[model samples]
Target: MGNTLKSVYDAKDNLKDYHVRAALQEDKGKGTTLMSWGLQDFTEKGDHYISVISGLVVRYGKGNSQIDETYIVKLSAPQVTKALRDMVAQGNKKEILFYRELLPAMNSELKKVGLNPLLTPQCLYANQDSENSVLILRDLCSRNFRKFPGKSCLDISHTRLILQELARFHSSSLLLKAAQGPQFVAKYDFLDKEWYNVTEDAIAFFITLFDGNIENGVAILKVLEGDKRTIRWLQTIKHNVYKILEEMMKERHSLHHCVARGLSGYDEYGNPIEAILLDFQIVRRASLVTDLHLLLNISVSGTDRKNNLENFLQLYYSSFKQVFDAAGLQVPFQFHELFQEYENKIMFGTLWALAVIPMIVSGGEPSEWASSHHRAASEEATGKQRESIDSKISSKHGELRARFLPIFDELIDQGIIH
Candidate 1:
């Protein structure tokens, strides 16, 4: 075990103590001893922060009658820069609150509607302090739950499963808001401004990096540079994006409001099991379209999205309606209305793509990439990073152009760009 693992295991906190006892209780053994442990850093590429996942093998009984059991532990990155640390701290706060408060309330609502609770992994222990956070969750892998390949896009079937689950997740919020009113909603409102912090930075990055690639890239840059109206709109959006998100959250009828998991497996019929939602670090009340755009953009391929976008949106709305009807709630919008909202809100996906697609293509660690921008005052370093990122984008040019050009074209057609 490393220093971080040693500290976590030796900590005297109630949460850690409870987890050790709970693990033993689940084994149904009289006594348990830590046999051995292994830690793996499973943080993805381009992740600005680190997540250390550990597996502990425990032994019960002695000699020939021993049984071994495993438990999973999650801990914050032991090392990170100050900027990254602050961002991680913010995300940690949201995730801890989700597990501690929001999830239980949502589960209660699900039960009220005679539905199974949300399908999150069972958390054995959760703790967050000023500088560090930890969560001990049941190892889903032990139950044969796997993850979808990160580099690939979801096919139609998997996409449907994800959308269905997302609809259910969003419905929980609707049910909660309807039953408990704004006060209940208010409790989870700590970081509605989360997106504001990223939007300007992302837009700046997009403009700086994407100026010469796409057909209309230069034109869009010109507008952003010279058009007072466009600049003002950007400023307005920066100032008020959180307020817009809050309003979207408050809306009852739209599937366009609101918001992942990796464990994958096959069911009795041999179909792939639905992926569970994980990571509530950035969860917020928002337009149903927020989640929809994210899913379509990130998970579905460009060609697939172009071909099946409307069908998927319709499918999502239908699923959303089914949940609302089952819960004895009214569906608020017609399919056409929802489709229009999707078109209007599709820019969210474009904005996200501006930041993420580059990273996806670059395949570079975020900390290294981010260091360049952090020192943006140095034109020499910034130019090198730009060239490196540009090369990566060129490598994946065909796929990205297919994925993003249509979105840009649509925006231009809609007069979102001049």
Candidate 2:
């Protein structure tokens, strides 16, 4: 084993030699020795110290009958800066809680409706400690699961599959809540807090991405500052974004209202197959439209999103309705009503795009933009970092500008923004 994997195994006293031998004996009816193991790192080079993700493939079995199993391990980052330790600790806690508690409850609901369980990797072990947190899960790649490319825009067919799966995710939460009651929902109340770390500095960072030119940035900031409604909304979000997100979550009964994934493949007909949702670190109970808006705006190309916006919304609603009907639940909102709800939630998409597009387009790493203390400071360090982020945004100004201009225009035209 590599040093990291060895460190992980060593950190947990339960994984000592005798226990491994006993477990192997239990699995194969005789003691088997671990033949060999290899590790591959999957951790992204980001600034935050959430955790390090790695794949560990092990060969073990009784003599002459060896087998290989691949597992993904999540371990807390080593030597993290004090500024980000709490956020990292919280993320680790939530993910461990998600796998240990939430997944089983959710799968139980899916089984009741005779549907397959949610598409998350199977968790083998989870332990939470601020200093030594670790989660081991089935490696989806071992099951032929592929992640959607992060650097490219999603095509229409891929977009459709994502929408369908998102609908099922939201529908599943509603079904679970309806069947089990608020107490069942309350078990996931850990998600009641604001998951996304949006802050004023983040907002300011994104504002610099608009129009790519200083003149356009100045104009947009002027409009944003001068508009009373916009000002109030930002102020409200700054103070109570999590509470607002909690209310939205309660309203929709959504399970994974954040970045999620599952296995992806194509059918024989070449159509995209539905993907399962995974990664619950930042999962929240929020507006169903929140997921839809973020995915459509960030993943799909601007022109395709513009052309198919209404169709995609309808598709999401239809999928949601179908799942509810299958579970013998009434579709709570009419199509027009849902459309209005979508309109009301347009700000989420706008805000998310503004905050996310710069990173996506410029390939910038996440920083302490989510930190309140960082936001409060106007030091030379913050100024230098802001300039670096702006320079990165300026590098991809044309592409980023194209993607966002139309989105802003529509928000303005619809009277969603002043």
Candidate 3:
């Protein structure tokens, strides 16, 4: 539980930001818990704070949840620091902005629209001076499911529900923008937020983290890094991963994909259910197709990938186009054209995943992540925080090659990846 903070910082690197000023020690109040095993990769290190893990908690609703009224609760935590106290003495905008302004604003909007299913946390509290911040919100351990990086594959039913809702959510936002105007729209803006705690320094940070192998991922990144034709493609594009998602929503071509996404009984149950969108961390504005492409590129099961590329791609396009026709929005580009663009970017995902995925695959024993913090208390820990270096190591590059190469092969066959 104590070491959880380290794991969180390891994946995110941002938590360590405020942790700089050491507060000897103070009793931080009890927090909440979210789902631990969202994805099954042994390499992916998850948030700490788990005590005991029992695989996936597949059953949805259970006892009364304590986090938020709108969504089922899972894991949560709070951090207190001496620096935070001094800041309270100084009065900082960073304090009120996150605690007072952002979350409450989102909650108010969701309530007004009568849309309560969005699992985003309602803001809890942030002390301006102490820099002490506590985010009290609902966690989605049992309710939400996570789909991780894989190539072309049939969308799983749980993920499909999320994808459909993603379209609807974007449409709703656009509709709200139409009715309320741009000023009203800015309140819900997640545009400026950082993802995976990756900021501009991430490129350099990667250099430090990978040491030797940074070149491997860099090779792919430099493909555009030097291609001044695209300007600072990775530099710019990587930063706006969230906005790019909204772009996907904007480029959405059809509602049929959303409808059909709901049709498949692809989850644990054989019945269709609304997609459960996990990880609101990267939720933001983009062309609708961007989400489709990201979802296509990042999630998807390999078994499904190998067996169903053609049909899956067909389903994605047909259903997506159906929705757009109803909305009177021309798809940004033809599906084939989109594939060509994606083919060029396939290595982007591969390279990034290469660095992280091995850690996930070899992360350690599959267990429940009982809290939102990072490391579980019961496990061994040292320094900031790190998974026990695996006894049987897994090479991240190798796993990526296995997963990505097949897709690259297909793209080559289809003449997509140039």
What's the lDDT for residue 250 in model 3?
47
Score candidate 3 by lDDT.
0.35
Question: Which stretches of candidate 2 lie above 4 Å from their native place?
Answer: 1-36, 42-49, 78-83, 193-252, 260-263, 267-271, 368-376
Model 3 residue runs over 4 Å out of place are: 1-155, 173-190, 193-203, 206-272, 287-290, 313-341, 364-418
TM-score of each: 0.76, 0.76, 0.47
Task: Give model 3's TM-score versus the native structure.
Answer: 0.47
Record all residue pairs in model 2 with backbone atoms less than 3 Å apart, i.e. clashing: 249-285, 249-286, 261-278
Highest-lDDT candidate: 2
Clashes of each: 12, 3, 61
User: What is the per-residue lDDT of model 1 for residues 208-256, given as tens digits with 9 covering 90 to 100?
Assistant: 3232122123223232243444434444354343444345455334223
lDDT (10s digit) by residue, model 3, range 1-418: 1123333222232222222111101112333233122212122234222211112111122245533222221122222222222322222233235335443444344455554533333333333223223222222334543323322233465454545455544544444444456575366443433222233343333233333223222343233232332223333344344343333344322211211111122347645554443323234344444455445444554455557545555555564454445446665457687455554445444333334333334443222111212223343432112222222232434444544334334434554333
Error of 1 at 212 (Å): 14
